[model samples]
Target: MLIFVLQTLAEILAGGTSLTSTKQIDFGHPIDRREEATEPILNVYVYDLRESKQLQHSGRQFERNKTGSMQTANVSWPPTWIDVSLLLTAWDKTTLGEHHLLAEALTILLRHRSLREEFLVPELRGHGNLSMTVAIEPAIEISSLWSALTIPLRAALFLTVTVPFEAQTVPKSLVWDRIVSIRNKCLPGSDVMTITKRVAIAGIVKNAVTNLPLTDTTISVVGTEITALSSEEGLFFIEDLHFGNYVVRIDCPNYLPQTVNFLVESQTYVIKEVLLTPV
Candidate 1:
């Protein structure tokens, strides 16, 4: 989950139209990364992680399905909110170049307040607990951090991301697979008459004017928590859907939101191409 958070955060920064696709995002110790750097880069270092003191809670959280069946995913123990602190520094050949990159990144960070469900992996989805704050003051001594890394203190942004830490990582698909495997074989005169199958909604998001793929666009089922983010090529696939009609909404940073209605009966339903006009 920690690694997913970092990767998603990087995608938000360097992917899509956020930054010029050429800018590289590197993670690890700044000193080590600096020596290996071959081009201008954004160095992200996760400096600290601790359970959030303000949002503490105990016990389990629960939810129910449309059929009144208890959703096992939500029936697990309550998650502990962990605060992840990241140190973001821009590395470039020239000081002016690095400063310009930082300013651009600052603008992007200020626009986002939460890690949307569209960006989270399957196991970490459902809960809207991955939140972010940028330009926060460092909890640790900045000078000490620089000294420990054996690098000079430089301009950097301290980003804090509060994430839910689950006691166990359970993929909902795996849970269903285990249950189905128990009833793997169906003999003659068997009571099993239905076989459950996972369904998907797949499509591409494109710029209305440029006709180019738009990455990081949110693809959400209007009435459900199901969501998926468009990939680098602008393709998105929301899986685990059952047989039903769905209302999907597409959203991106600068584009106007779009809504489309479609029916799903096949294992994979391809949504018509979506075009979003700039606002």
Candidate 2:
């Protein structure tokens, strides 16, 4: 279960497009006393898109047939419901947000370079789990998920797996963080002039441990009324300033003071990349 959860998350985060929900029957209905019994086969596949409400992938089918009289047809009943939502809920969305985690993971697992496609077969087990035997490279990591027998199979079938990004990361707030100065150089055999220009300086405070991007770092140009705040991208841009030497500073409650000296020239824009060191 853990491997499957991680596999799905990894696939989604890697931008995979296809998703599959599969099931297998280990023991089909027994041969009826009065008639020949038939086995059942089922596989459901769904495709994801950039927009919500994606379509299901076509060409997959499920089939089941009854063979004997009602009395003779009595056989072991296969589990009909399987809920995959709980495992999906535990995924780390911050790393794979906006990516199709299931599909990519399947692709990685399906790729067995040494084995031919005919030899490498993947079949879902009776418990809604996938199993494959092929000559391939094993994944770098594999987690064994503990199985739970909470809900009955039929009731569990309705639960959907959703990894919401909002729940994984803290919401970012607006903040002003840094000050930058752009300067123009007009030099000749005569005199050199230094002018002060203001540029944008802003970046989010990210946790070194979790690497989650932070927002609301205070940014300002010293001795000036100009100020700006970092956006969700941890970027802050300042506009309209004379070119010259300027000190760009970033101040946040938990992080250390981060500053840079930059000179902007002419109509060109200057960009500074700041990584806030964790205190």
Candidate 3:
């Protein structure tokens, strides 16, 4: 029997979730000088890592209570802001089970309160549950039974959270560990998945004048959008590259963009280094 597990960590920003007043009611209470009602005001802002940009000019209203005790607001039409985002990293993809694990990890993030406020609540408001579809650049093909069993289960887990007015404050180090545990829980057995594809692709990035390993340089695959940075040791790993042709781009302010094409084949790997020169 083959067992698969999913794992992921979702970090929610502060103030990602909030409460808004939907209806104005007099309550037929005596309006006296002793008891004055403070009118509720609505505030909207972008939830990106950058400072909040007020959407006051957008003129969108808070959606009234759908039911229970919840009032919510919409970010904006067409969802122009990238405030809520996702950073997914797959440690293993050699087995079909790992793909299932990846799907499950993402499912956990979509429902996590911090993830919701950061990514989902901006667009959906009131008591309604968030509907999010996971999109990967280089899609993974998996079994019908796995998808049928995992997809809705993941969605149900996300719907179970009570949305908060602020992003969840979790320690950065704990985030990675917590998601791994959560992924294991979603599966039938095992705590972690061992990676089969671990290869080092080393190279030197230097100044045109002085040849050296360009420390702190970022290497990214165009199609997969997967990336890694060269260490002070001047070595980096593009771990777990799926089978395909990709354009590797190197970016540095002082140097011109370095673009190269490489192919990653199944069960086999390549070791190639790059040299970036100043323009």
Q: Which one is best on lDDT?
A: 1
Q: Which stretches of candidate 1 lie over 4 Å from their true place?
A: 16-23, 32-36, 61-75, 169-279
Itemize residue pairs with steric clashes in candidate 1: none
Model 2 lDDT tens row, 1-279: 323333443333233323332222111221221122122211111211121132222232233333331111112322222223221111122324213333343344355312222332232222332223222221111122111223222110111232211112211211222334322221235343232333323234454555555467667877678777765545566555444566878776777778867564433454555667668
TM-scores for all candidates: the values are: 0.51, 0.26, 0.28
Q: Write the per-residue lDDT of candidate 1 for residues 3-63, one digit (tens) a residue.
A: 8787787888886323555348878687644445567788888999998886767876555
Q: Evaluate model 3: give its lDDT.
A: 0.37
- For residues 198-236, write the lDDT of model 3, one tens digit per residue: 442323355555555567888887866688886554555
TM-score of 3: 0.28
Which RMSD values do the candidates have, in order?
21.7, 25.0, 27.0
lDDT of 2 at 212: 51
Candidate 1 vs candidate 2: which has greater TM-score? 1
Give each model's whole-structure lDDT.
0.71, 0.35, 0.37
lDDT of 2: 0.35
